[model samples]
Target chain A: MTTVFKKTPVLTDTVMHYCPGCGHGIVHRLVAEVIEELGIQDRTIGFVPVGCAVFGYKYFAVDCVEAAHGRAPAAATGCKRVNPNNVVFTYQGDGDLASIGAAEIVHAAHRGEKITTIFINNAIYGMTGGQMAPTTLVGQKTTTSPYGRDPEHCGKPLRVAEMIATIEGAAYVERVSVDSVPNIIKAKAAIKKAFQCQLDGKGFALVEVLSSCPTNWGKSPAEAMDWIKSDMIPYYPLGVKKDRTNE
Target chain B: MVSKVTIDENRCKGCGLCVRACPKKIMQLSKTKLNEKGYHPAEVIDQGACIACASCARTCPDAVITVEKE
Candidate 1:
């Protein structure tokens, strides 16, 4: 029998703080696995934003900084600018990037900052009691929107990957998910490519991972996966949004 | 050539999607009670007839299903 796979070395032995069935832990492991595979854990630095994954410092065995709410890109910008040789990346949620830190993300992408950004869009705000976020699906109920999101009043979910890819400075952009094992593997590869783009001085790179908030979605872990396949994928649409690698 | 499907009860949420997604009709969710997470997980009744089609594993959200050759 052939060995399927093994855990990544860059990940610490500490158990993740995320809730059971949360997708953050899966994405975290993928990032760590990529870092270990590329042999860059020693020089890697991660910036954690204010969200469910704010405790990223505890999981990754490397230098990590807790950025101000939604200001991770700004902090990562400074870190990569000052220490150009170090591997710098920002882990941000939809609430952080699409809401509070929108300006920071746009500016960073516009300036072509040499950094990688991992964007987790689970639709609802997992932290702070499952409120409707900027990326929340229309007709999706949250603490703020009980009758499901309304386009006439609250506006539609922002497609961050497509929006960010339009920027001239962004060298690579992709949207993936952890709904299945095959997709999870593909997502890891996309994330690794984003990091490699930054390493090559290719400019701003972003990987938007469509995650699941099972607790907030009022569904079991299994239902959340089905929801992702039926609802999230249709709106977000997986694939490479932009790639300037050939350029 | 009977393959048995085993589920890690601790991780299952008893969502019943796998039971709904199964094509072989070999699995049914346990209606007897709940697990540690208070969710009713699916249990295999006729394990001897499983063909290892992987439908349950594919539909499972928690990655808790394990298939073994008996």
Candidate 2:
């Protein structure tokens, strides 16, 4: 039989552990495809966090290490330092990266660590039963913020990409989403470039993926996609934050 | 045309919407089982009857479904 689409080599044969309509599977596939295309699967070392994407290590076909909540960046830093010849990347969620690990991520970028960081911001905490995260939108209703996120009491969402772009140590930063085919393509390109930045010996590189949590948002898969386009995109605009070599 | 339905067990909030969305009467919620993320997911029965319409997957809020043809 002719094959229209087959599983990518970088993905494991085991079934995925993501939720239905969760964007982690799509993002994981994109990253895997890029790793295969770049032929860096064998040399890539991945650090996974403790949020919804904690099982990322099991999905990818590269060497992976699991870190404590919001500690992937620190772990990736140590990994890169020890294995200078290999490529290192960290796959983190908003709750893990933007909240608990915010300090670690900021320092990693401030120091210009030669590594790639994939930040998946779905607006809420998924693994911990849909709590309000640092990236949750204003007026967004989460389990912790049942009355909607009040800016006065809860503060505002952290725009990590824009903030990191201002740091001279960071050579590349971008925020993209997979709400549509076009957006998914753009996200893949940004992710590939983030890795390429590391390969080129550039400074800190990060890709913030504006993803969806349909279950938490109480919207269907299609509606969640629409929300990312209509609501999330405006708050986290899709584009490259910075590029040192203009590549 | 065969329809596809996938379940992301970990991401499932145990909402049972997939069971309600399946019009072909081929899905059900798991009660005796729980995934790594601590949620019971709807399982597919009689996979051969799927119409590839993706209704269950589309209606899912968690994006847990991955439907494909046989």
Candidate 3:
């Protein structure tokens, strides 16, 4: 018999603390698999953000540093600068990346930091009980936006991938989703390419993943997946936003 | 073609994603048994019906399912 599917060894045996059906787990597995496939397990450094995945250090079986809220990019920049040869990446959620650490991320991309960032945009703050985030879609309701998001007051959702792609320093940028098996495969491929971009001494790379928050969104797992397809994908379309690798 | 599927009962969170992804309609969450985490783990009822597509494993967020083909 041949094994068709199994867990990658880059991830620790510790069970993830994410909610059932949370996209973090799927993305986490993809990152781990990429690190393993690249054979960079020993030199990889991951920055864990202060969100639902704050415990990310416990799952990834590699060097991990806990960064202040939304400051994962800043922390990763320091680590990559110091090590130079190490593979550095940051795993951040919507609140941590688009809201609080907005400046840090933009500056990192502006400076063309040699690092990769796995940005999970679930549209709501999962760790803090589903508060409306900067990436929260128009008319989407959250704890803070109890009556549905009012774009007149709250403003439209932020498109981080597109914004980063416009920057001159960013060498690679892509937006992908994990709503289905095919998309998951594509997400992994995008992640692999982002890491390869860094290995080839390219500038900054980021893959914005349109993830789901079933519990926070007040939807069943299946419904959450469907929502990503129906609502999220339209707003945050998946594909390569920018690529300077061949150049 | 024969395929075997094994779900880590202890690791499953009863999310039912595998059940939804299974094209053969053979996967189901346990109605009687519950895991240590108090969730009904997924199980394959008609193993013969499994096509070894591994879609269930791919969609599973918890990575609890393993698929093998003979």
Quick one: how many clashes does candidate 3 have? 0
lDDT of 2 by residue, A178-247 (tens): 7865677788899999998899998799999988887789997657878998999999998989989464
Show model 3 residue runs off by greater than 4 Å: none
lDDT by candidate, in order shown:
0.85, 0.83, 0.95
Best by TM-score: 3
TM-score of every candidate: 0.82, 0.79, 0.99
Estimate how well candidate 2 is docked, as a DockQ score. Answer: 0.10
Candidate 2, residue A172: Cα displacement in angstroms equals 0.8
Candidate No. with top DockQ:
3
Q: After superposition, how far is residue A160 of candidate 2 from its true place, in Å?
A: 0.8
lDDT of 1 by residue, A1-247 (tens): 2222334568776656566567787788888878998889999999999989899998899999999998999999999999999999999999999999999999999999999999999998998999999999999999999999999999999999999999999999999998876787799899999989988899999999998888899887667877999999999999999999767
Every model's DockQ: 0.15, 0.10, 0.82
Candidates, ranked, TM-score: 3, 1, 2
B1-70 per-residue lDDT for model 3 (tens digits) = 8999999999999888888888899999999999999999999999998899999998888888889999
Question: Candidate 3 lDDT, tens digit per residue, A93-168?
Answer: 9999999999999999999999999999999999989999999999999999999999999999999999999999
After superposing candidate 1 on the true structure, give the runs of residues whose Cα lies further than 4 Å from its correct spot: B1-70
What range of 10 consecutive residues in model 2 chain A has the weakest lDDT sum?
A: A1-10
